[model samples]
Target: MLFGKKKDKVHFNPGNRDDGSHEQEIDKDYVEEEVNKIEEDDVEVVLNNEENIDKKFSGNNTLSKYVELGRIMISMLKDVKNGNYKNIPWFTIATIVMALLYVLNPMDIVPDFIPGLGYIDDVAVLTMGVGWIESDLHRYLDWRMENDMGI
Candidate 1:
């Protein structure tokens, strides 16, 4: 909550460039434009919001969707941590943060080891977390596009 209050005025590093390319191997500019964006703002910018939750859970809560999404989210985290999924910088940042939380907090909605049952809650929450991260990344990507950056 404290971070939320000061998000509008806080900006993190603005010129740190990474060595990454997109799937097409295109050299994404990926420059830090420092548009008055803050650390907390960047975090939210990389994540999806409540609206996405409604959409993702709109029609029906299928088990398979959860399984597939969970796998993808997990894979994304692994890639980010391993330096493979390097294109989505903001997304990677969010994923890494969420993974840290998941590891530190033991009281998640679902137990971490009840086979398929335990996975239900974990997948849902993690999927949402990744979505938020993705949203934040999109915000930055849009900024990049508008500025004609390669990102």
Candidate 2:
């Protein structure tokens, strides 16, 4: 119900508008509701589409900044799947999956086909997701180092 019965797609637009009028504010509650719906299979889809996701990130300079962080997030999910790491909370995992899913979708808020401006929202989502999960991510990093898991 997040996209009015459009189960396959979700989009978000944030910040001020060009005409000096607020178009729409991101519905945080709705977003949280949808993100919480994400499951392990959803995360697996993102992992399975890693090639396409990497292409999307590498195709845009702005999105490229998030590539490393995205990799780390994906790695953490893989670790959780393999039972190699379980310190992360499900909410954190869900958040990461949501962000990755957002990135994988080309027809997002701004539509990736548009040059220059398309990736702005993606960067925002990735940045927000990272901010939300920073502590858990750091813990995962520490655990990664201790386990000699190179990333």
Candidate 3:
């Protein structure tokens, strides 16, 4: 077996330092662009997975799951309109964004194109939002505590 050479850990010092060196900075925008590029490829791979194209969840199929989730999100919005999740507007908004991101993630568990892992990632993100929703239930319940129909 060939042994690989180990790299030394980076050391940084602000003053009294020899061999003055600075970390190369990567542009945040460039990094984000690269990440988006990779995700797009992942989406293509997921879309091409034949085995993952027909999986079923609940009373609907995988594609249906995404649509159903969208409907549920609308219902959640109605709940918000009625004032269910209060005092946690940021949390609700973040949760909504995460949910949307998950829905938009084409490469998921079993690789939807692969037959099993295709929808896994989306499901995982959804599960996380659900858990957060549950933990933040009190905030929502508080919102439901009163109706200021004076508007």
Top candidate on TM-score is 2
Q: Which ten residues in a row have the lowest lDDT in candidate 2?
A: 1-10
Clashes of each: 12, 0, 15
What is the C-alpha lDDT profile of model 1 across 51-149, one tens digit per residue?
Answer: 342233233456456434433444443444455445554434544344334322346555645555544444444544444355644554555466564
lDDT of 2: 0.73
Ranking by lDDT: 2, 3, 1
The predictions' CA RMSDs to the true structure, in order, are: 16.0, 7.6, 17.4
Residue-wise lDDT of candidate 2 within 53-84, one digit each (tens)? 77778865655668888888888888877778
Clashes of 2: 0
| Residue 51 accuracy (lDDT) in model 1 | 34
Error of 3 at 3 (Å): 57
TM-score of 1: 0.32
Off by over 4 Å in 3: 1-70, 78-88, 108-111, 135-151
Across 1-151, the per-residue lDDT of candidate 3 in tens digits comes to: 0111122222212244223221112222332333233322332343343223223333346457545544444344445444553344433444544455444545633354665645555565554455445545444444445553211
TM-score rank, highest first? 2, 3, 1
**Whole-model alpha-carbon lDDT for candidate 3:** 0.41
* Per-model TM values vs. the true structure: 0.32, 0.78, 0.39
